[model samples]
Target: MGQLVNIAAHSFTAQDLLRMERVLLDALEFRVSNVTAFTALHLLVQGLPGTRPPVAALAVYLLELCLLDYTLLEVPPTHQAAAALLLAMHTHGTAGAQAPRLLRLARVEPAALARAAGRLVRIHRDAARPPTEALGALLAPIVSKYSRPSWCHAALCAPLDAVDPAWCSC
Candidate 1:
């Protein structure tokens, strides 16, 4: 097993290695995880009403944020995806009540989802503030577009500092 693992490590890209590590962690518990949660979110958003543009935008934003912050990679994609959906729902303000149902459909646990969301919320909040020289390059355009109240009426730019700090602890 160790030999095979070493050989695979030499052949995989950084993203592939990280994904494999996540799978190994999940496999130890004998459960499933949303390795393709990004794809799933893309498809899932289309089925919902009046949520496609904003939700999709937020989801993509969250993914990009995760890419910027390697610490977020510790969380599974399913939980991250769920959190993004919840944030998007919050942005829309129309489906906040449906978060549980939406997460259930995505096969994610609420606690895990909340934890992942907290991290993302912090990322979003921090990225929105000034001294954005590092985060601004990637996030500024997104913040500008989503921050607008008229852009699909998404609430993605709402102050995340107001949310519970516990949401970020995994």
Candidate 2:
């Protein structure tokens, strides 16, 4: 039988979730090789808040979305991070004219990041759709884990289909 990782394990506490959240934030906001790139994410996400899409959470969700698609793995982490950030901003309907400015600050080309983000969006759309029995079997745990109102705060459950087709209209 396949080994099942029990979510109910005492060792697997909310602290683990907290740590994961911090790690994702760190990865998205500070892990780029260039300090300016990290700073760029910080600047872009700082001011926007309050019942709006959680920028940090969206970035992390997009990262998880990327992980599910093997092709995205081939992209450089910096590019992938940039793409995820852009997708997160777009998903929140906050992208507007900020995409190009942020990309310029990160020293990433807008075209490449847009292509990568498009792929991420497509993957998210596929995953967010109602699943068939086999697909449901695969997605159930992921959905269940992120659906927990207490932990991820449903960040992973937010609708990605809301992403605009232009991705970066700006």
Candidate 3:
């Protein structure tokens, strides 16, 4: 079973599966090297059973944004996944007691998660702006795909205006 199939078993729709397939095919066709983050994103979703569909979708969206920013490569994939989940939970108003458990599961400290989430926030903000001429074509397809209802319109969700300082105290 492929990673996408495993992910689909959890909460993804058929359209989501197809989109993932297309991405993988494109990567293979282009001979893109070092695509571990994309695999990590799928693993993250698979690891967290019972995650709500919307939250998972949002997390996926955040991780995809990370793929576009080379600076985010400094963060570990597990940390990125954790941070994306944290931000998604907060965005969807599903965060609370489960936050600590999530951190524990990802083996990520609160501080690290906070820093990663902060970076994601910045990426999300920049993604919302009209893209630069150089990268516009590259970024448009991804943003547009996630904006659709099939993907929970994740890209359409408002970027976090501010991450709560207290949330990191966990």
* Candidate with best lDDT: 3
The residue pairs that clash in candidate 2, if any, are none
Ranking by TM-score: 3, 1, 2
Each prediction's Cα lDDT score?
A: 0.65, 0.60, 0.79
Task: Write down the RMSD of candidate 3 (Cα, Å).
Answer: 12.4
Each candidate's TM vs. the true structure?
Answer: 0.60, 0.56, 0.70
The alpha-carbon lDDT assigned to residue 158 of candidate 1 equals 60
User: What TM value does model 3 have?
Assistant: 0.70
Which residue pairs come into collision in candidate 3?
A: none
Q: lDDT score of model 1?
A: 0.65
Candidate 1 regions off by >4 Å?
1-34, 46-52, 130-132, 137-156, 162-170
**For candidate 2, what is the TM-score?**
0.56
lDDT per residue for candidate 1 within 1-170, as digits (tens), equals 44665777767566676688789978887655445658767655655655656666766676666667778868877677767777766655645546546755667655676777778878777766645686677677666666575555342556445444333223
Query: Between 1 and 2, whose TM-score is larger?
Result: 1
